[model samples]
Target: MKGYVHSVESFSTLDGPGIRSVVFLQGCPLRCQYCHNPDTWQMNEGNLVDSAEVIARVLKNKNYIARNGGVTISGGEPTAQIDFLAELLKGFKEAGLHTAVDTSGYVDLDDIDRIIDDTDLFIVDIKHMDPEKCRELTGRSNEKVLALLGHLENLHQAVWIRNVLLPGFTDTEKHISDLCAYVQKLQNVQNFEVLPYHALAKAKYQDLDLPYKLDGISEFDSKQLLQYQDMIQKYYSKKFSIQHDAWM
Candidate 1:
């Protein structure tokens, strides 16, 4: 089967463990306000390639991936194209490569189940904890996202929770505490990442002629990010008995 692919990054260090070959799949249901790859929103506007072709491309740099690193399917929400993603993950797994998916966790549970067995890691982005605020930021409710997390937990899937710290929007003590509390209950959560918000995607919005929702919002400085990370680590350590290094 052919997958609509936006692009590929051969060597990505931050996507998962060690280094990885990141596949940027096309199409996303959520219109996240801070999305940098706005061009990947359209399902039909990408290079259609068979799973073999994509796998071949990744294998070209197999040595670089080594054991700790492998392949990651990102998007435009990779699970939006479930069949193709499943096929791609199967191919990666068969090749002895660690597979990871970077998703918003807004996909249907069935779609996720189709590829979960083949996936090694899930980098889930939790936009916002509050349902209304989640809708405001991502143009979708958090119900499906939360449900996806629950499903993954039920299956005992390994997951890395990623939260974007948007100042004045999602970076409040109430929000962080609530999120930490909820995450602490998930037994399958392997890591927690607090990503600082940035305006790097504003130019992309301008290029795509799309209205930038967070136009005036300023990016958080290093100090703010460090503080948030410290707070989150402290909460996780104290409440869940998971060390900061274990999840970070």
Candidate 2:
């Protein structure tokens, strides 16, 4: 099968464990205000690669993956290319490679299930706690995402939940507390990450000829994070830190 790809990072440390082959698939339905990879939102706008080619490259990095971590398929939304991912992950599994899918959780349950069957870990981005806010922030409702989480829980799949903590947009006290409460209901949640928003993607919006909505917005402060962290920690027993990579 063929998949549209925005780009590929051969060796990435922050994407997963030790070193990982991160495939940035193209096309997304969401219109996140703080999206860094604005260029990836367009469908069929990137390189077209065969699953066999991807698997071949990933196999060559097995030593690094075995030593560090594994391959993580990130995207404009990996579920958008479900069949391709299923094939790629199956091949990786055959080669004894650990596979992860980093997604927005906006997909058909059947497609997600197929990928999950071949996947080892699921790294998901929970856009918002409030359905209304979620719709506003991502151009769609969060019902599907919430349902995806519930499905993962029911299947006992390991998941790493991530939230972009945009100070004014997403870091409200009520929102954080609500998300904390919701996460408490899930099982097999391996980690929870709080990603603070930054203007690193402003240039991308400019290049795409799109308006950068969150312009002039300051990054989150230490105190703000502490307040939200304390609230989330009340529900989340596992502690997580802010990502420090260039992509964060």
Candidate 3:
């Protein structure tokens, strides 16, 4: 089967463990205010590549990505093209490679179930903890995203939680506390990351003739991000069995 692919990165250290070949698939259902890749929102804008072609690309870089790395199918939401993602992950798994998916976790349960067994890890992005705020930021409710987390926990799937700290928006104590509280209950959560928001992609929005909703919102400094991370770690340590050091 073929999938709409926006781009590919041969070596990505942040998307998953070790060095991975990241596939940026096309299309997304959300119009996040802080979204950097507005270019990927269009489902039909990318090139259609067959599963074999994608697998071949990963195979070519197998030597470098073999140890702790493999393939990470990221968005525009991988589940948007469920069949292709399932086929790609299955092919990579059969080749003895670890596979991961970086998603917003807004996909339908049925689509996710189809590829769950073949997936090694999930980098789930929680846009916000409050339902209203989540909807305001991403044009979608937090219900599906949170539900996906619970579903992954029930399936015993390893997950890395990513929360972007958008200052004056998602950087509030209440938001972080609520998020940590919920995440602490999930036994399958392996890592919790706090990513600081940046306006680096503003130019991309201009190039695409799209509005940068986060315009004028200053980026958080490293120190501020560390403070937020410290708060999250402290809360998780106090509320969960997992140690504070487990967070990233």
**Across residues 1-248, which tens digit of lDDT does each residue of candidate 3 receive?**
88899999899777878899999999999988878788889998898899899899889999999899989999788888888889999999999999999999889999988998899999998999988888999999899998999999999999988887787778888887888888888899888777777787889999988888888888766677677767778667733222222111
Q: Model 3 residue 148 lDDT?
A: 93
lDDT of 1 by residue, 1-248 (tens): 99899999899878888989999999999998878789999998899999999999999999999578999999998988999999999999999999999999888887887887899999898899999999998899899889989888988999988887778778898898889988989999988777667777788888888999888888766676678777777667633221222111
- By lDDT, the better pick of 2 and 3 is 3
Q: What is the full ranking by lDDT, best candidate first?
A: 1, 3, 2
lDDT, residue 170, model 3: 84
Q: What is the lDDT of candidate 3?
A: 0.85
> Deviation in angstroms for 146 in model 1?
1.0
CA-only RMSD, every prediction? 3.3, 1.6, 3.4
Which ten contiguous residues of candidate 3 have the minimum total lDDT? 239-248
What overall lDDT, based on C-alpha atoms, would model 2 receive against the true structure? 0.82
| Per-residue lDDT of 154 in model 3 | 91
Per-model CA lDDT versus the true structure: 0.85, 0.82, 0.85
